[model samples]
Target: MVHKEVADHIRSWRFIVLLALIVLTFITSMYVSLRNIKPAVSNISDPDHLFLYLKLLTTTDNTIPPFHVFISFLGPLLGISLGFDAINAEKNNGTLIRLMAQPVYRDNLLLSKFTGAMVIIATLFISLCLLMLGGGLLLTGVRIEPQELLRIATFIVFTIVYVSFWLALAILLSIQFKQAATSALTAIGVWLFFTVFYPIVVNLVIRAFLPDPSFLSRDEIAGYNEMILNILRVAPGQLYADATTTLLMPSVRSLGPLTMEQLAGAIPTPLPFKESLLIVWPQVSGLLAATVVCFAFSYYLFMRREIRS
Candidate 1:
């Protein structure tokens, strides 16, 4: 069943289009980063060029944003496209009922859809990372450090989990809505809300609450800023951005606003791989929890759903 689903997705036009968009964005972003590679390396003082490879992915030129930024914005689209019709399409074509009539368990059927989609997503991300590494080395003539390569590997893993959250959400919508079009539009609507409008709305709300920051004390203003930052982190996009920033930019020591005391003796240096992972562990856990919740709810609903049609 997983094999059949994988083959079907490979042949699907939706998959083809999404894959093309990712590839185009990735190549464009890498090209932009490569153009600025000289500045990126020269600005740093590390003898080993510890993050030369990471700079390739995170540094941006005038034309395009960083590769991680592109993934943060568009990765959910791939998940939604792959999963928005997973169950409803099967039911719409009458194949779902036929498949259920076989000896296969319902658990197996739903699990197959998610597993197949994940396999495809993982393969796409791995290939893109390798492509960026090869291009970065060839274009810049720099060697990647062992730690830097580990950070890239970690980023790819985080990306997979981040995207899987959306995939699960889309599948849950598919389970809830009988029409594929309905599920697809609803998923995209949610994505747009989080990706584009959510930040605007958050800022507006914060402004309404603190219209006169000048009236507040310094500590009060700092508190308000921290509060606003926390509110923004409610969006998955923000969480992914924070996590990826910490991973890709070794100089990022903390995700939150730092006090003067905390920065008093701080040196400007990249963090070790272990410390970077520690900083982003909460964000990673949140993403994983959200993904599991969506999938579990979808599984429950799918099992209880009536399939007369």
Candidate 2:
């Protein structure tokens, strides 16, 4: 019974649409990145656009092209959308009672739901990443080695963690709201607040509170600017970005000098993978724990609620 429910959920049209969207976005990103490469410098007869491309790719941010930024923002939103009604919808359809009457344990239902959603997320995330890797190899003609593969694997795992955070939030909302639509809307609202509006609000507050003094020189103005930014670093986006930098970048001599340009320049290092893991292990674990906590709270609400027709 549990397996059937999971399979039916996975086979829904929503899953197909989500999968298609993921692939389309992934392809678009690769196409744009490859198409936008500047002409290579003339040198010896042997020209390596692939190596030059990857090197240049990580060395700087694309001011005109912002696909990477979109991925970072959209990944979590996708997770939340998929999960916002995992439970509430079943309840609404009068299927929850039917399922609970089966031989399967109550625990199996919840576990299978989470597992199914995760399977979908993982599939799309890995597919997009592999597409990026395949495109890189095709353009550069460079063979991927064990180390490079390791970096990609770690990055994919991080993406899963990031998405899981939003999924957990969705589950919590679904349990709190009886209606699926309301749960979804609430989840999206929270997503926008944290991912979009919250940062803008923080910036406005910072500007209002710490305005640049008209009397100050350029250096003083820079100091004031840095002060405001440092204060804003307390925001969730800043913390997540910091954790991502520590995980993805090879070396970080100082976090103080971080700017948009600096982050773009910071590429994955060839350092011991475990060392990078140790640095960001806390963040990775913290996010996963938060996800678990959110779901646990949902479980409490869900188990205690009275179901009615």
Candidate 3:
């Protein structure tokens, strides 16, 4: 019964539609990036600016492209939309009771739904990633470095966990909210709070606390900004961005911003990518763990909910 429910859920159009959108986004991003790229020019167009152009095309420069930003910002919205009605819709249609009448257990039903949704999510995420890689090869004809490919794969996996956080939140709300629309809206509102409104609120709080303009020195002001960001970094988006910078930019040792001269001085002597990964692994692990913790809480909430007949 559990397997059947998982299979039927995967066959649904909602899952298929998300898969299509993921592929479409992958193609669109690659096409636009390839189209916009300028041919490599040897003549110095501002020696300072030359590195920026090279970084854009290089594998390690993980600056969020259009495809990346879409996945980071909008992927969670899709997850929430798919899951917000997972429970409530069935209850509304009177199918909940009918399903319960079968020999299946409630734990099996809930577990199957969550597992199936995650399977579809992982499939869509990986498909989009591979599609982007193929498109990049066809358009630019550039061979992707193995390390770069691994970094991209890591980014995609992290993205799935990030989106799953919102999906879990939606499932938790669905258990609480009874009405599908209300559950969906609540999930979106929470998304907005984490993605948009929370940052604004944090800025406001910082500004209010540091009202005097000339009270702090340059170093003190930098310290204040760091403090604000540290507090706000509790959000998954911020954590992901921090982790991504470490993955994409080999020079990012500390989160502190440095001038070009300072950056040059601080560059590792041997510049081994493994060293870079070692430096950033803790940050990456933290973000992944936080994502799992959020979903685990949701699972606990879901299992405890009373689905009234």
What's the CA RMSD for each of the models? 1.7, 5.4, 4.4
Give lDDT: candidate 3, residue 151: 65
Model 1 agreement with the true structure over 41-82: per-residue lDDT tens digits:
787564324578888887776677888988987899999998
Best by TM-score: 1
lDDT of each: 0.89, 0.65, 0.67
Query: Residues 242-264, candidate 2, lDDT per residue (tens digit)?
Result: 55565444453344444455567
- How close to the true structure is residue 15 of candidate 2, measured as C-alpha lDDT? 64
TM-score of each candidate? Answer: 0.95, 0.76, 0.80
lDDT of 2 at 181: 85
Model 1, position 162: C-alpha lDDT score: 93
Q: Rank the candidates by TM-score, best first.
A: 1, 3, 2
Off by over 4 Å in 3: 1-22, 38-65, 211-213, 258-264, 268-283
Number of colliding residue pairs in each model: 0, 1, 0
Instruction: Report the C-alpha lDDT of model 3 over 1-309, residue by residue, as the tens digit.
Output: 546655765677866776677667666655555554543223244221222222333322234365666666768776786688878888888988888888977767777767777777777778766766776667656677766666666776777777777777777778778899999888888778888999999998789979575976666777787788778887777776766666555445677544455566553432245765776666567766765665676667666766666
TM-score of 1: 0.95
Model 2 residue 31 CA deviation (Å) reads: 1.5
Give candidate 2 regions above 4 Å deviation.
Answer: 1-6, 36-67, 211-240, 243-255, 258-279
